[model samples]
Target: MKRLPPLPALHTFLVTAQCCNFTRAAEQLHITQGAVSRQIAGLEDHLGYELFIRLARGLELTAEGREWLPKIQQVFDLIGDSVEQIGAKRETLQLKAPSCVMRWLLPRLMQWQRERPDAPVKLTASLQHGVDFQREQFDAAVIYGTAPHDLPAALHMFDEQLTPVCSPMLLKGAPGLNAPADLQQHLLLHPTHDDQDWALWLKAADLRLSNIGSGQHFETLDQAMSMASHGTGVAIGDWSLIGDDLNAGRLVTPFDLKVKTGLGYYVVAPDRPEPSAKLRELMVWLVEQAHTR
Candidate 1:
């Protein structure tokens, strides 16, 4: 059998490549920037080729590095999945959720941990809105959209209610946002490239703006909401997901109106004749939390 490169060096290379900066990678890895540099250098020497082209500002992956990245990620993912499926880790409930719901889901998970320290939950956040239980290892998932018909159990959490949210500073600014029409005077942050969320809200409000697609756009609702909280622009946010932000005054609703998109978030589990008592208990607790929120 052939010898493999040091696992620590490979892990360091992976983190450095993902961050594109030795300093940031060092911060994430809890090591000195010099140590990160050394690991990358060692990995490059072992591979007999340079993986990254270090620039003054940051690093850029060489062709070889780019090609090797996904393969390395898969290797690590498989290793992680294998470890979690065996022994004591297997008893922990694995949950997957879209990143859009972090504002709501994270706090609840923390509360759940406090209440039931014995029943641990391993959460994996992803960009994907839906999950395929057969292919994924999660015991349950928080899905956004219409209820999934194929799942054995799908517990409705809340409806998708869209409303404009921004920093409280926007409320005091000129051309005050007294009504939906006042949006024309301010920037509109779109959570998607297609600007569908903003469009949906506008259509529901029976209002239209010529520059609907004109402001900053983000890849996720969370990013748009973050910018909105900073007073960058007004974002069409899911009302349920931004409760914490609203409570903390980091964001505020500009209008009282909320438009229901006929979509919602649900806690779904795969088809199983009899789920574990712990899984059932977690799902019930999640639904109760959702209702209370």
Candidate 2:
């Protein structure tokens, strides 16, 4: 069997490789830059090869470092997975999802808990597109996108459709938006970096407006939906995220038209040799809920 470098040194090396700078890696790891440098040097000495090339500008990974980074990450992830499996006696299941999904799912999860009172759940709401299930403690995640690769198990929840929505207040004002073309006169709240939803929906509706991109920008779908709920402006909403809000009258679809983007919500579980039965039950419940709605 091949000997391995010290765990601390290997961790420091991985952080340094990720940030490509000792100072940034140290800051993230909550250690001093000098300590980071020392660990990297120790790791390189143990391995008998320089992992990083120190330049005046900053640290850059050597060819060997670049090749080893993913392998090291995988090792740490595997260690975390093993620890989680060993400590699986605890009944709580850690689940992660985007904030928008959390907003929609949290209220509904009461039913999940009620149905299976013995199976407790822990919800972690994050904006991250995908959770590193092996490295992170999340037993499963509800991710919004095309089917993510490398998961041991995945269930398609629902297809996503982009539809324009806003508070009822937007409909009462002068020059009110009665038609899709009238959207040109109001603000278009963007959920992400681009106005792809608005552009796609408009093209699908056959309404050409150059100024459709003009509007408020937010980093997450939840933020955009909130702004629209409060009558700030019209925003395109993901059907999977804003279905409850739409039904509750918090938001109203200004147009009946919807454009399917092919991307959808998926429940994903980590690639484990023996998958947890509890997580499988939760995944099944999620799919059932998606279908019933």
Candidate 3:
């Protein structure tokens, strides 16, 4: 902290130096000229140097001021860069999608961080997260919905399919679950996710249930998946989201049935211009990293 100046005073001094007139600088800064003068004076006293010489016409940069201008500009430039970096570090990578997508994306970010190291990835759970991407200061968005539809300049990163997931303990205990009717004996964990996921999975297997799904409903896929992980119940999980857990032996699908949803993960940027290198790197890495899943 000792290496830094009083921010307000430094701001005043910079503006005054730019205009070379306290009055104009005050107007630009919406402060009184006297305040500007006092700030510059305080800065000079702190440095044991005079930065300006007053004249009836206006103000002139002293020899010291002339020497300091470039250094001061460099300091201000450094400050600006530091602030941008901080903003980027904590920025919200708003995602307009289901909570399950958030769960999936965040865990995999470690791969990207291993490369960029400084990239900050934030996630939001909403279907409309990308609508105000610019105004909300979002660097990029990962949307979950049917694709081959119109998207922003961003790329379609990955395609997702559905697979059944259940707690290992539950599946072992429930037994007879090789077919859909046996599911009636157990709780069906659902968050009212994508339409027909359960129905399609059953349809593919030529099975139906009068009450195949009768259990407490969750509000988010993350919640449902968590319960499934704990052997609480069975759920229809998007492969893209639960694929890692399945591979890691944390969860498993006892059945081989699979079906594709109309939905997939899309990495959308604005329609206007090329996304910044940072956003581009983030977007590309996300797609490439998850495509195999």
Candidate 4:
């Protein structure tokens, strides 16, 4: 390792050089004038050079001291930059959720941010099918499944309830929906995923849909729900994911029956000795949101 003067001595040298007066430098540094003088003397001795000239009125920097000022100032600037970058990284948070749940959770998350003001959550809209949480740097994630693996802890947020929903306008127009069997008269939207939500609901109601495969198919439940809300067709949706639309009158469950799907939403977090304070607060808030829903 390279030998260098003590850090405190370097600080004192920089302060004394800037003021060119020991008494003023000590006052600025919140130290006794004698202590400032000692530190400067020690630094000069370590460097094997005379750094100042004692004058009748005050003091003046020598040739070497003037040349060293800029270099020392650069060092302080670098240190300050490094500290700020580290602080910013610590404050940031990363989170992941499926696209469908993201739409429903985002508004509630905004409310949480407004209430807390200090804790912020960064959301990543992702599907769980191909994700590897263990390889990623997410602070937490929301997953839909019966059980999630490779997590320190998984908190079940809510179970999915599948119900047939469509725009009120659809009910007012041609082939209006009145019962599960009446669904054959109108278009049926299907999600690309093989959740078989429609088939499950049909089985619960003791009914069958032979043309279920013919209707327009969407990549996500969000897309199918969007089509349903526009009166295009009927789509099976989880009540948890469409609560806002239900309350806002954009979509309505025509039937009273709700089929309980085995899958559920869970908050998955890494295992550790103790959870972060922010993460703990978020988990609690998520549970509350699910309960109220």
In order of listing, the candidates' clash counts read: 0, 0, 1, 1
TM agreement with the true structure for every prediction: 0.72, 0.66, 0.62, 0.67
Span of ten consecutive residues with least summed lDDT in model 2: 82-91
Off by over 4 Å in 2: 1-90
Which order, best to worst by TM-score? 1, 4, 2, 3
**2 against 3, candidate with superior lDDT:** 2
Candidate 3, position 186, lDDT: 67
Q: After best superposition, candidate 1 residue 97: deviation in angstroms?
A: 0.8
**Cα lDDT of model 1 by residue, 147-206, tens digit:** 888886888899989999999999998878888888999999887768888888888889
Write out the backbone clash pairs for model 3. Answer: 97-126
Candidates 1 and 3: which is better by lDDT? 1
- Give the alpha-carbon lDDT of every model: 0.84, 0.80, 0.69, 0.79
lDDT by residue (164-253, candidate 3, tens digit) is: 788777766745566656777667777463436677777877877665545645545665676677676778777767877788787888
- For residue 113, give model 3's deviation from the true position in Å: 2.6
Residue 56, candidate 2: Cα error in Å is: 38
In candidate 2, the residue pairs with backbone N, CA or C atoms under 3 Å apart (3 or more residues apart, or in different chains) clash, namely: none
Q: For model 2, how does the per-residue alpha-carbon lDDT over 93-175 read when each residue is reduced to its tens digit? A: 88898765765688678788778866777777776767886578778888988877667588989888889999988899866
Root-mean-square deviation per candidate: 11.2, 14.8, 19.5, 24.6
- Which stretches of model 4 miss by more than 4 angstroms? 1-90, 129-131, 149-152, 193-195
